[model samples]
Target: MAKHDLDPNYLDPNYEPVVNRSGNHPFHEVLAARLQRRSVMKGTVGAALASLMGVTLVGCSSDDDDDAADSADSSGGSASAATELGFKAIPVSTANQVVVPEGYSAVPFLPWGTPITGAYPEFQADASNTGAEQEQQVGMHHDGLHFFPIDQKAGGNSSTEGLLVMNHEYINQDALHPNGATAAADNLGVRPEDEVRKEIAAHGVSVVHIKQDSNGTWDLVFGSPFNRRITGGTEMDIRGPLRGYCKLVTRFSPSATETRGTLNNCSMGPTPWGTYLAAEENWHGYFANSEVNPPREQTRHGVGSSSRYDWELAAGGADAYVRFDVTPGLGDPDTDYRNEANTYGYMVEIDPFTPEAKPQKRTALGRFGHEGVIFAPAVEGKPVVCYSGDDSRFEYIYKFVSSQPYSAATAGGYLLDEGTLYVARFNDDGTGEWLSLSLEDDDFAAKVTAANGSMVGDINFTGFADQADVLLNTRLAADIAGATPMDRPEWGAVDPNTGEVYFTLTNNSQRTEGQTDAANPIAENRTGHIIRWSEAGGDHAATSFDWDIFVFAGEQGTETVVDGEAVVTLDDDNIFNSPDGLWFDYNGRLWIQTDGSDAAPYQNNMMLAANPVTREIKRFFVGPVGCEVTGVVTTPDVKTMFVNIQHPEVDWPFGTEGDHPRDATVIVTRDDGGVVGA
Candidate 1:
């Protein structure tokens, strides 16, 4: 969530190290196989080889084509993919403002610190709001979001009004405090108690009632009952395998059934039964462990000697702030906070419709740096299926299949609490299998034994003690299962029209030529690629699937190297890098967003619309300088879309150049009042 400088040192909160020492098969060879398969499909090796080098299979046309293709139903539900992308591709820009198509409007909404509840404290541009006051305002750095209709029972599609619920991934410390943090610039001194509290309060999710007027203007409903803030200090119930595990036993929750706060939430998903699943990402940097050889759970996750922010070093050393220190003391496990970090890194289920309900951390989903989670369409009598990617270099992608059949009337978070978490093994031959991580399964245990006998790395292939241990150290379990190590797998989305799943492998510059595979074909992949897969027999719970590369991000006229040679390149209209946010509208338009470097032809982060059937992509919108364009959704009517711009370098949307830039939501709509992107 922090500025991704891609540093290897653990000092930066956002630096995700290559902790995977699994020595599994590299994804590079898989790329070669895919090339061979395409060649055979073309019926001529030479012609297909030549065409592959050009890599124009997925073309980006600059022309403003308005061909009516396919579209979904009016309710944003599954329908024929017959709608064509009607907008002209916008050019890349570095200016400190949002740019959209000719017939669209981009308006800023819900900037950080806006009051939504309690005493309705006003936002202070100078950053002088107290921690208590911040609790009543929207949290900072908005990420994944959804618009829940005001009246849920009435088909849940009210475009006029709804509750906008979104995650505040993290805080911009420099702009959060009156004069930056109370600690030294390098963060060396003890932090003031209130400043630490405010920082914690700014790191969760915000739920506020929002509405649209007849003039097409939108604003928050002041003091609505649905308005609420879930911060790092809010108490949450723990469910699934790790609920009462000893490793989760901390002083605050001695019973190990509850924990305080959710941190570093990234992308999100909605349950079929109408709930929000906020994913916790990059949370390992929040805790510090002083032990010379910390437990595998802490060390494996890259929990270092010092935390990103020294909340544990707060002046008063209250229990609330001291819990950030995971260093074990002379006291017993229940007497300290060593296991506090174990309570995080799960998909937290929040019921926005019920403001009084406590959020539940669904542990059935494996614990890792979850970029996001997306569920497959729920079938009345079939088990629920979902996919999540661990957003770390060379980490594995995971899937959770619920044990109970999905029933529309009875579905809830309880189904998520009982499931089997599996890691993906993307074979070089294009076929992939799901490796079970469930400790109760005999086959998985045998695989662990085999890996232990042959393993040769810093990681000890010790067998898992129970399901709780496996879920707590999910990466380790994945390692033993021989899951394919990908190139920093991030957000994933499932196509509503076809059950295919797509994921953005946000760039991994560390990958070498030798590590490149069919799935991750590029060497030193500065510009990432998108990969999609179809489940066997159209079964979401199937153990196998077929995958292929969808698109590779690069600049026009520049050589994009793969396996030590130039093979793929992009065109002017859709040149981009580091694809992060991905989504699919009901009409099946695949929306792709970038969080790339502000270098060369691509000046700022942008979003693009892709026609999945035709393999055509076109630029849609561009954000201000140094801002990551993410979190997108459309009203059921498809007339309006909401996207978030986070941590802009320049002051924007209401601030002068000298003032601090604030993260806010951008509202996009059509001037002619037609469906957006069509």
Candidate 2:
């Protein structure tokens, strides 16, 4: 068969496709090999610099001490984090319940399928909750979340009572169904319509009002007006540049200004204006693109013949199910649901305070596979800057700075609609450049004026009809601009004190020999690392910056080299791999979470706290079996921490009442009533 004929995305009907959703890295290695060929010469200068950096970072001792290496690295890293952690590290565990340090306490709360509204319904012992029941109950797989104090004024951070907003990434089918899933045509894999609907309703975001009891323990307010669920079937608005794009026109909204629901909501970001940014990751798997002439954009994003859940095969052939089949029919695009897929893959904005408001997809942020959106410290009179990672093997990191300067009196979604979007290209020399994706940028227009590739003909990419086209087809624009691809960029956070941006590049097994980049120094990086950068001249709006490999994740005592220079040496207390969720506390300490597949000693996923300046990393918490430790936040006082433990097996949080354990949101606080992580 011809090479093109064998392409699963195009010709193959029997294609058994897989996109590596199991926190693996093999796909990244393969993509690195291909990109290395295209950008090999580009790394020539980077090799030498990486060698020098290896000497500076790789040979450090893993003594887990306070004084020895602290002074050595403090001079170069963040001064605010120069002090070491005050507590001893927790030992690794294989238990089926949450574990924490001796001085701290962890309590599981708000498990999935719990009710907080008038539509209250119990998650039965048989796990037979209907689609309607799941619709109003808390969704499954609680991920990232935030606490908004009910009494805190606008633009203020709350430390007392408030609403807890969170993301529900996906569902656990076995735990959500009775007797497991039963396809009507058992062998054919056709799921019951009601079962499929229930799953859809369980995938999205949840906002519930939470308050601290008189005893200082947190409890959910069962019937607060703020308690709401924005699920995959809820109505939403298609805002920003793509609002009226021709490609977004569909039978549901030919005007391209509206759509339905948000799915695959993962790692979240809370806006300074009190709203929440729920990122859509791996959303392509929820959609099945059936167009005969599948656009390269759709295929590259992983929208194909089949989906992970096969929602399209729901028995009733309802519009909700049929819409997932994005195959263009013989009729016009507006006559069918062909463009419904285009309406998704965005950073959705939701207002927890306003329960009546529909979520809005901010298209100007540029869509691919958004893990989350985090903002830098906002300076009065300065424009707001936000960063996002396109969570996939060989995807790119993106930045968006509002066009207008900050106005606390006027800051809102308007700032997002008018901005410049740029993609990161990390150089080997510890420095990087931000390539513009905006059509209005002179440099970007010049680079694509005559660009030609396998996807586009010998036409000028700058000739796109409008800015909406650039934003809607953002992934393509980033590729055309020569942005560097990364190994599954996930969640990101900014250091409040130094304004340094940190992103988690999860494991990438696709990287073959000699395909390693300085930021990703190891071959077949099953264990990931953290990459951080400071904008040029320390200006958040700058287009260039300096960067470095903050730390390499692996088993204790493991050593990694970059360009032949010995870099990171892991130790018992600091050893961790597949660093996934990341956020810096107000104290300048970075909290690292993982979703790893490491061996027994490192079997359970964990969370650690690091003093970057002192080079101190201490494991703080370890999760239960078959669970993901993700999404974390704290009250303004930093007295209590909120975290999400997703999809734990053998049931947790809700006890052994049901057939399976329930995923939950946990509250961690100091036993002495002191600030957490102090």
Which candidate number would show the highest lDDT if scored against the true structure?
1
Model 2 steric clash total: 16
Query: Where is the poorest 10-residue window by lDDT in model 1?
Result: 41-50
lDDT of each: 0.80, 0.74
Candidate with maximal TM-score? 1
Off by over 4 Å in 2: 1-55, 58-74, 77-83, 154-157, 187-190, 453-463, 514-522, 560-568, 657-659
TM-score per candidate, chains pooled: 0.91, 0.89
Which digits, one per residue and each the tens of the lDDT, describe model 1 over residues 314-426?
Answer: 87779999999999878987899999999989999999989999999999898899988999999999999999999988888999999999998888999999989999998
Candidate 2, 406-453: lDDT as tens digits: 877777777888889999887655567898997778878866675533
